[model samples]
Target chain A: MNGLLIAIKSETFIALRTFASKLIVAAPALVAAAQLLLVRLTEAGQQARDSLLGGSNFEADVANNAYGFFVDSLSTGLTMLGLLLVAQAAYSYSYERDIGSIRHILIRRVSRRSLLSAKLIHLHVLALLSVLLLLVSSYLLSGMLWEYSAIVEDGFELISESEIREEITLGIQLALLPLPAAIAFGLLISVSAQSATQAVSTALGITLAIDIFKGLLGGSGPLSLCEFPAFPDRPVLFTIRQSHSARLFRCIDR
Target chain B: MQALSVTGLNKKYGSFAVLDDLNLQIDKGSIHGLVGLNGSGKTTTIECILGLQEFNSGSITALGYPPPQLHLSKGRLVAIFDSPSLHPNLTVRQCLEHALLLCEKPKRSTEDVETLLGISRFRDFKIKNLSLGNKRRASIAQALLGDPEFIVLDEPFNGLDAEGVDDVLELIRTLNRDQGTTFLLCSHQLPYLEQICSHIAILHKGKISHSDTINNLLGNTQTILQLKTAETEAASKVLETISGAELIDIDTDGYLNIRISGADSIAINQAMVENKIPVAELILKRASLAGLFREITSEDA
Candidate 1:
């Protein structure tokens, strides 16, 4: 049990302090920011229609508006979670070896099986935390901006409450479905790797290949969404919003 | 019961034989010294004894049980390598904690072990930041943690200062006296081993060239007597009356050194007392491991 704890702590430390964690957080936030910028440019025609038109109106457009901010936030959150698994699972085995901790561990009475299990558990926990952080950060950032716009528009109302809940729920599923595969593939790569560099390189390459192949074989015959676990044939964003205006509102709430 | 036993153990690496028909036995409650020149397969033998390496032939038994069945013996046995095998990043406290976790119950205090090794100051320092001597102290502390029934230490005093060496020597003596811990120590430091070990085994070319109890090995080998002679004639006369003593060489300073082959201390005293050749100094010297080693090895070479 002590050995298991040590292994878990080691993984947690690496995930929290390493470059991988930063990338997981940054990639999705950047995507959301770019989407907000593009929406603001397209919405200049709607400025007359929007009573909340102002210098910082883009943030308000998504923030008070449920669908636009929600979808944007959800996509960013799921991508960050996937990236965490991609980074951690890929480098798990080889990292310990490169750091020379493998010698110390193997010499102890702990079995290799327990060590591997502990690593997997640690990785999963970190993945969950990363996902949580991404979701919370995007929601809060979009919420603040949307609330500001609602206040300036003479009232704090922009989108309905039902649409807001639906967008958030759909976002969570979109981020969650790929979790098991990420963990399994990470374990496979980590076990097969002899060093950290090799593990990271191999896992990343394999993840890229699998993702590309999954995309290519996505709609082909038996390889359709029905064959995948919790696979989505159509984007969940479309179902999340009832109308085009609602879709924009949902994306902003995300 | 024998603490450790290895019989006809054979091993090879890529057609090069490392250990060929090697056999060794260490009795319980005995401090055994293993001495060998460089590349004499000492480390390999130690590794094989610890079950770290797979031997091709023969078997090893610890505490009367074969290695495969020696699971219980593992906790009872501990080994200290020639090099300081420690994680450089961990502090001494962390290192001991990790080692103690691996050991069975009846926990020992890390404080006690640290004080015993005189490394309390290094308890919080990372192993990498420590001096070589302190690193050895930490290693020794780890070995002493479980207070195992048997221990194998390889060149333990290599990097220790005199004071540190004495502390270790005293600890080993105390453990041996109080708990009867069987020890198999391999070192080229003959004087240090001579001070503590009861039995000695010298390995040469993957085989034990010589092995015997320290007292027996010393008492059985010939002793060299260095005597200062006032008169060469008188010294020669005095030497002729001594039985079982051969004069090896005489210096220009009138020093007569003769080899006495047996444990007859009284015969030499009587002869010298009778001769009364103005005896300046009468010293009986035992053959050291170094002299014996050079003679045995060069003769073979």
Candidate 2:
């Protein structure tokens, strides 16, 4: 048990540090900052319409309208996370090859299974942490903006606390669920790839294919590979002022 | 006891046969030096023994466990390769720590390894930042972590300076002596291998051409002799005492160059002294591996 934990810790630490060490926590933070900008935009739109377009209901339109930008930012951040997985895994394997580290590892008492497992698990943890940080930041910044607008005057329907929390939680969960698939895909590519460029380009190419297939598959159905659609229906990550928001929040809470 | 036994191992990469009918037996507690020319399949053999390469046919038993049942020999068989195979993005400390964590046995504290390898200065430095020699040392340190029963090192001295070589050689000696460690060292450097390895296996064209105790193998092989004698007639007479000795035609300069297998300098010296032949100078030269390799391969061709 101790050895396993140590292995897990070492694997995770190396993976996280490798990704974080480069450019130093800037990319994910930048993504979060962009989402915050969207929040600010939504807040400004709400403020301008409070007097003319009615108070609470107008705020709902503002938040609902900003959903597209939020989804875009989150998707971009996820894409970056995917890039991180592909790059780190590819670099990890290729650099090990160059340095003869693979020989060293193979000659050790460790099983090939453990080595491969540690790598996949490590990469997943790193990707998860980056996603979590981005999601947390985006939610907090956007929530703060929504709260600030609530201070001036009551809109048609102010977002309740529980509703905000549920949306944030669900949004994060939704973003995180696809990550395992991405990591598994990345690992499959990394193992077979001889070079980092080959690994990254291949992984990106596959992601693009999935995106294209997802676009071609149209419907409220899950993004199955075969159901090719033209455009995706965006999920509203957060809601604003609506007259029945409290009741809706209560129903969702139940 | 045999530390490793490989028989009829065959491997092919696409159409190229990397290892064919390769057979070797390394005795426990002996340093077995594996020698070959470039593309002679030394690395491939090591990789096969280490269970890193999939063999097409044949069997390998290392430290009493068959491979690719390599997990059974986990922590018992370890190897280091020519390329200092380590994660470059990892600090020397991180590499060690991770390697330790991965080993079957609990890893010893890093302090001992750090001190032994004199890598304290670069413990915090990433592998890419360390010089080649330091990386090699770190690799050795990592290989030694599990107190393995057998170690296979491929061209470990390739990038080391004299001091680094001495340091590594000393460490290898200590490990073998203190722990009863068996080593299969692959190298093109014969002189260096002669110093450390008790047994030698010579590979040519993906086959084991010769394998024997280093001394016996060297003893039976012929050596080139470059001699300058004061009296060519007396030297020839003295040399006649040694059987199987041949005189290559001398140049305009009366240099008595002979190829001899059956005799050493002492025998010739005794014969000269006994026969009242005045001996001005006698030189016995050791043949390098390249000479032996060429002789073996060209004869095959």
Candidate 3:
């Protein structure tokens, strides 16, 4: 409908001009890059110490794999991204309502439903951009610091490169599968809340509370907390499953 | 044709009634003022009309669309609220540009509206940094970008200075005159309403207690003529003899107040002169919107 398009244009206009949207897009990548840098620095120091002692170990070999570091960086970045997106989603609508700016669009060119749909679409676009940037920065930094190869132990292959790539693909799919639900929940909270501050605090509080509660209940099979190691096999799988329940919970919310 | 019509409107919050069987109609191309007390459901009525909230029961048609479908009008309807409805982080120009995205068919450029609102200099000012008055001017300027057929303004004069008020009033008058734009202004500013509104509706006790043309509504109330005379007794006697003239009060300052209906100053002065009552100072206080509003509200209270 024409009204829906106008609403989307209005949403896009504000998102392009405001700093909040940019913050959401760039902050995750920046944090992930810093994390990769810190890890690489620490690993280099440990390697220097090992050479001084005239010794090396298996832990060093496993830690030197770019895939593991890449997955770790993604885990940290995605966890932060999830929280940031929820908070931003909560803040977006309620803040506009607090300032009374949303009323004009409602009265002039669009219905409430269209305005909501436009916000949902806008936030998703921001999420996608943020994720893309996070992926590039984390992938590049991890590759620079560590070698991209199969996990090898004494000439016998523990894990092949093809297997690692497939697992990473599956990990990313699983982690991202629940994001739409998370964003929807944030919007629901935003609309339900009385103020921007209330909406942000409540949404984040609920997310953290669920994370803690899930961790305490002894999550079934793989690691469940995206923030914590949920799976023992792959760093990639742990991060993927950590976000799974929340995404599932988000669908229920939707 | 009517620009707005509400019939059998009933709205309640829990057990308390806000609008009870309310009905109102606004003729097209007329500037109507909606005046009411605090918590008297003025803004509530507006929210219902704009479809921002669901009414308990009623039918509201604004510009021929139901409240829920007002958006189908596509920029033909606009509303400016008491608070400046703008993104605090955006500069005035950016905000106007953002608003332009919603205007399906814009009639004026951003610069023209900024100039009209006297906010050209503040075009680069962020909404958060601008003074309340400037912010309001910018808000008004955004509304002017589209040639809206119907505009609803709630407390439009809240943050305006005297000069700003004059500019807005002039702007409203011009738009109504030139473009035949219909306006529903809800404000506590009675004097400005009197100056600009063609019609007035007084909401009281959850209903439209009074609604009519400015002249017709004010005309129903009595006009007080205060005269300080040399012969107070003769002046009282002269007024008693005149039809539709009742001596209401005599102040300690030796001024006599008479409430007269269906009589002009000429007739009152002629009667006094014929009786040889010496009139030194005379002030005719015609019924005003403020006075009538006060009278009606106080009576209801």
Candidate 4:
């Protein structure tokens, strides 16, 4: 137990002084913010074109809700974050081994198992911070670009604001479920690899392979569960967007 | 008490053996040098001893702890590898502070070790930006944060200049004298080892060919005298009458190579003068660790 604490302290000491950990924590938020900005600019151009033609559509306004864009930004950010986490986790161990730094910690006071556990914990902490930053930045940027409101068509309320929030919350929870598994998988590849370059390349390669083949597997097994949260075409993001549209269509039919 | 012990150790890679029934024991407060050829498994032995790799068959103990459990010693055992095993991106000061995290009871501050290693000016420099010698200095500085009872160094003097080597030798002497620290140094630099190490172990043919005090090992080796004389026949006859002198060979350079056990150079010169043999040149080659190592390693070749 004492050895484990010392290992964690050493890991934290290095992470605080290094740039890779900071990249892992901040890169996702920056990319997500850039994505939100691009989408807002495109939407404003479409609005200006519509106004010039004097053709104002109610459905267009409904489709431009903040919730949808927020979900989209989350998807983009999570996709990048997923890859970054895997690459970072894979690089962490093998890079240290390549430089032969791990031998000192192993011979000094920390055991092999303790050092591995500390790395796992450190990666998870970085993931958590990244997710929090992603959530806050996406939420703020989406709200700034568009108004958060219910789906209303011809003065008839289709979905309430609380219902939209609950559905989006559920979508985000489902998207975040597979991240820990991704980190663990990367670390597994790290320890087995012969060099840092091989570890990072192999881990990213295997992850991409799984992501590409997930649809062919019918999305039924455990492997697909790990792939759902990280890819851009994930079902949870689309479900939230489609559920809003489906509700408005059902009310129109009634 | 023995600081480290390896008994009947056997390690093999597939079908080839690297260490076969190798045994070595290092007493506390003594500096032991492990000398071997390029492919003699010096690094492999250090790795197995530190639990960095697994051995096929062996029973090794360092500071009363097995290789896997060496961590239980709580910063009592440390090793400086051939390559400076440090984070390349971290500054020298940051590396020392990071090493302090592993020291249960740090005996020296970051400033202390940096100054001791003469790397105070390079404290803020990144390890990758420093020269190989300064990188090694930073590596050694980190290892000295704690008062380690047993320290293992592999190729400790690979990159250092003359001054750096002298500083390290002085540090080792002070630690072994004041703190009673035990060191196991594995290096190819035989002359440096002879100057710093109190005991020597020669690893040859997958086993220790010689292991003893520096005096015992070098004292047992006979000195060689290269005698060049105008009257070679007369010199050979006079050398045969000497009690401890034996003529080994006459080289192509017309110099008589004589192996002397208990005879002095002056006595041989006097005998040559009494026999009317004028000596042109005479050279005395004293026994050294390098010479002894060459003799032991070349026996099978």
State the displacement of the C-alpha of residue A51, model 1, in Å, after optimal TM-score superposition.
Answer: 11
> Comparing 3 and 4 by TM-score, which wins?
4
Candidate 4 lDDT over B1-301, as tens digits, reads 9999999888898899999999999999999999999889888888989998889997999999999999999889999999999999999999999999999899999999999999999999999999999999999999999999999999999899999999999999999999999999999999999999999999997898899999999999999999999789889999999999999999999999999998989999999988888999999999999999999989899
Name the better of 2 and 3 by TM-score. 3
lDDT at B89 for candidate 2? 79
Model 1 chain B scores worst on lDDT over the 10 consecutive residues at B66-75
Give the candidate number with the greatest lDDT.
4
Tens digits of per-residue lDDT, candidate 1, A1-254, equal 66566555545544554466566546655666565556555654466556554465545545546345546555544544555576677676666555444433443333455568777787666666666666666666656544422212335554456655654575456446567667667777777787767777776676556444666663362333222222223332333333334543533543
> What does each candidate score in C-alpha RMSD?
7.5, 5.4, 4.8, 2.4
Clashes by residue pair, model 3 = A223-A230, A223-A231, A224-A242, A226-A242
Q: Pick out the ten consecutive residues of candidate 4 chain A with the lowest summed lDDT.
A: A245-254
Candidates arranged by TM-score, highest first: 4, 3, 2, 1
Instruction: Write candidate 1's Cα lDDT for B79-123 as tens digits.
Output: 777767776667898878766755655346899889888889889
Q: Candidate 2's residue-wise lDDT over A223-245, tens digit each?
A: 34111111123222222111223
DockQ values per model: 0.12, 0.47, 0.73, 0.89
TM-score of chain B of 1: 0.89
- Residue B119 local lDDT, model 1: 88
Q: Considering TM-score, which of the candidate structures 2 and 4 is the better prediction for this target?
A: 4
Off by over 4 Å in 4: A219-223, A226-229, A232-236, A239-254
Worst 10 contiguous positions by lDDT, candidate 1 chain A: A225-234
- When candidate 4 is compared with the true two-chain complex, its DockQ is 0.89
> What TM-score against the true chain A does chain A of each candidate get?
0.65, 0.65, 0.87, 0.90
* Superposition error at B185 for model 4 (Å): 0.7
- List model 2 lDDT by residue over B135-189, tens digit each: 9899888877777888888898988899888887887898889888999999887
Question: Model 4 misses residue B99 by how many Å?
Answer: 0.5
